[model samples]
Target: MNTNAEGHLARQQRVGTLIDLFAATVEEHGARPAVSDESVTLTYAELWAKTEQVASGLRAFGVGQGDRVAIHLERGVDLLVAVLAVVRTGSAYVAIDVGYPEQRRVHMVHSARATVVVTDTAAQDSPWDEKLVTTTVGDLTEATADATPVVAPVAAADPASILFTSGTTGRPKGVELTHGGLVNFATNAALPRILPTDRMGQVSSVSFDAFHYELWCAIAAGAEVVVMPSVPELLGRDPRRELKRRGITTMLMPSMAVNHLAKEDRDAFAALRVLCTGGDVILPQACREILDGQFSGEFYNLYGPTEGTTACTAHRVTADLDAAQPVPIGVPLDGCRVHLLDADLQPVPAGGTGQIFIGGAGVARGYLDEPAETAARFVDIPCGSSWGRLYATGDLGRLRPDGLLEFLGRSDQQGKIRGYRVEPFELERTLRNCPLVEDAAVLVHGEGDGKQLAAFVELAEDGAPAAVRAYLSERLPDFLVPATLIKIEQIPATANGKRDNEALREILRDDLHRRERYQKPDSRTERYLADLFEELLGVEQVGTHDDFFALGGHSLLAFRMHRRITRDFGSGLQLQDVIRHSRLADLANALDADPTGRPIRA
Candidate 1:
């Protein structure tokens, strides 16, 4: 918790663009393995050559400074090449999620005003192909092999990437990040450094800011980047085996996955040399289990918003750390300043909770094409000796007497579900867009890993909850889709005409009791499954018809439960059985149908 003013200043003094740092790394470690997937491995020199070829292709097609190119490909070598190629062409890259709904993907591309899209999907299959130029990874690498590589002048303040995050206005806001911000993170000494000998795992979806952090940090350090499978798939299998097999030394995971893995397998991180978890509140129990178990590595809790780069602060977990107490978000990263201020924009008294304002080299260049919104969040604030720009993170926090920062949740309607930022207003807006829904309200419920979205909707005529949920599923990502949906006659409101959230919660509580009314387990299989559900989900008196997801079960937890069931019941009970038959009676029936089978190793 000690603030090293001199050290902080020294770390902030280094200035250069990502292009500069990556170029230097390539020269230093040209013979080392730079990036690899299951299919191929590319040395730093080979990666540089491939990047240069792709950059030449983009330049040949008129991509250069001040242009935005959308990269809409899955995570792998091609995705990495496309991003680097776009940056090499001196154009800001816009990442569009391949898994997002067509409407959402189109909105991101059109909203960013991208001049070209680099994707392998055919133009006929892509919805955003109209008007914009389309190219492929194969075309860029093969067609431009003989072309001259572009050498566009790079600057620290130039835009590098634009990442879209969930917004309360029902539209995703594009946060324009600069080369300086990314360089600041790569050069920051406060973080646990990734050595050239370490093999860092890349797991985050390309659309997320964490993807850039995972990729650039390792690239800048000349470390080996091992691109892993999707997060869900990794969690479903035993991660320790895979990590050890791949020789992954450093990685960052969502708090939900961290907690679940920590509990499911105490030796989950035995093979890792450094583990970091954030993006949501870290569960104390998970921290305790990991630190007390087989993880013999550095552990940290990183905190920040997309507007403040990937991470602004970090808390290192030590042997004497008390899991019972709230974990501090720790001190600001080098070159960063965290100010806790009141509503009047004045600094709050020491040890008082206030809105968190972050000022640092990592602060973003503001939202793209929205001057009003940009001015609202990013403002010029007082630094120590001079005035500097600060992003007003709506998150609330307080500095402890020991100088560590404690996160106190958000001051706005936005919430984090399984590490993904979600705004209930966006979900509500999407719900209202459905013809069956007359009106709707969405609220985040539960705590820690059990947190979920619950939606209440008023039907237009003979609308059903299932049909409305299906409608939302087609439009929103799986995480944004509400886990629990209920039909309501009207939205509760107070006398002041404001939506009465407390009343809505009360209704939700009552409805939960009515819908999942307790029914005693009728058979041995049912009783065993019921007890397991209660133990895993921390719910009391789970009924036969009670659904797992409604009872606060998620994919990671489902994987853990699946392992336990397979270990005790039989291997015949596949992981999909738990998801498909989430009800207690239904799962019990599945076990009965396939009673005799081999047991799966835990």
Candidate 2:
């Protein structure tokens, strides 16, 4: 840790894998704190020693190089140890988010064909127990008590991790990443902003690619990576206040999270020295607000795919961000190449939108067990230099005249919601899998700035939309679940046997503008709620059945709506109610029940 940037670079140059770089950090500063959660802190030496023991135990348990080891633990010291142990064994780790349903976890683990699952004590009896070996983090000490410390031989090209993301075919695909790509990202992109003494919050969900950026880069810098006590709550006392309490200096938040924070916590936000954000497009208004706030931190807009080892491009947001124009995604990382290509793979001129193609050391080895998809997406660029295969990002963006790149929109059906990449086919396929569902069409609906998932479902038998939503909730992650559900007579189709795009749009438009459901104020409470919902959602009329999120209401709007409800009616509507009870009917009932507007949490 005493080494300067030059010496740190030299050490990293000698290492081939992330584990090796971590080992170098441990050797240089064994006593410095490397990782911590609310309850415990582990120094670099302690982490390395524990990881070696766990690696030895893994070897004793028949874990070998390149084997897939599923880490299903929560965000804590044990989770970090499991990840390091897998790396120390030269095995690619598969991260399973703690809150994911068993079905989703099963699908991901089966897809990766993971040989072992390291989880907490409660998850020892998962459905995959018969197919794979299971171990609890609590038992790692005992299991490795008799085993000797050892670091397995690792190579630069060996598979380092397998991150599962949404697939068009309804199943999640495992994106295979290599040690080289991981190291390249840390060296070229992350190191410039993070330093040895910098403390960054580990705020990203474990399954997300951003988590990798937050974890590995901090380890490379010998910086403390504190586990956020809450998920994506920028104004919370547990995580946000905890970060400030611990004097955390840096963090990489998603754009949505930053946007929400900008609205309320100007004083709290100005505390950091480095803040990097990007997942979907950042609203210029939000960016300008944050930049013009109390925070003087370096704010960056990063863009990339899981296939590009986290981020391939980054731009430091300047004070010139205007509401009329988009914040640029910026230039490529050092040693990375960005190609904005047309349909024919020809380079598009500057200021012309094209499919983003990344070619460089950061390009991953494509999806696992899907050779056709791999070949289709990761194609060889005809005019590429020694960069090799180019990863088709399937995102449209243009190179600005100033050498920066501005993101447009997705060229495919995939879209991002709350920073998680989602595909409608995945939700539609899950809907069709339901026993009563005969036909379904999942669409991304909304205009200007954001989108939300909607499902127009036709069931064989009489079914409730709420029931269908609940069933889907058991299989899909919360972010992938559609905020709106529409029951239909049948899925409209054209002569070509495909979905009738025009008809579907008409259906959506009619639902939005359905004048039949519109009624005058029935009561004082109803009038108040209707006016509030209409104003917050920017809709003309509000029906009791009209959903808030379906009409383009997001977390930010929900917060604003809740604030007004409290001030106007003297009813302290909780934030949870606004987000969860999005229906006017449900909220109206809640409001009527409590004069204070306080929900009972039933």
Best by TM-score: 1
What's the residue-level lDDT of 217 in candidate 2?
Answer: 82
Alpha-carbon shift of residue 580 in model 1 (angstroms): 1.8
For 1-602, candidate 2 gives per-residue lDDT tens digits of: 01124543454468779878888889987888988988999999999888888888778778989799999988888899899889889899999997888899988888899998998888888788496889876576677876776757788788989999886766799999998888877766433568878887887888989988888888877888888754434332323466678788888887776765665554455668888888877878888787777778788889999999999888888787766888888888765778889999988876888999987778899899999989999998775444357999999998777877888889998988878889999898899899868889988877434577878999767777878888987888877888667788988999999889679878877776664476565656766777788776667778777677766676656766776667565775577866788878788877887766543221
- Ten consecutive residues with minimal summed lDDT in candidate 2? 1-10
- Runs in model 1 deviating more than 4 A are 1-15, 121-124, 383-385, 595-602
CA lDDT for candidate 2: 0.79
| Candidate 2: stretches off by over 4 Å | 1-12, 189-192, 230-242, 384-387, 519-528, 543-574, 577-582, 585-602
lDDT of each: 0.85, 0.79
Displacement of the residue 96 alpha carbon in candidate 1, Å = 2.4
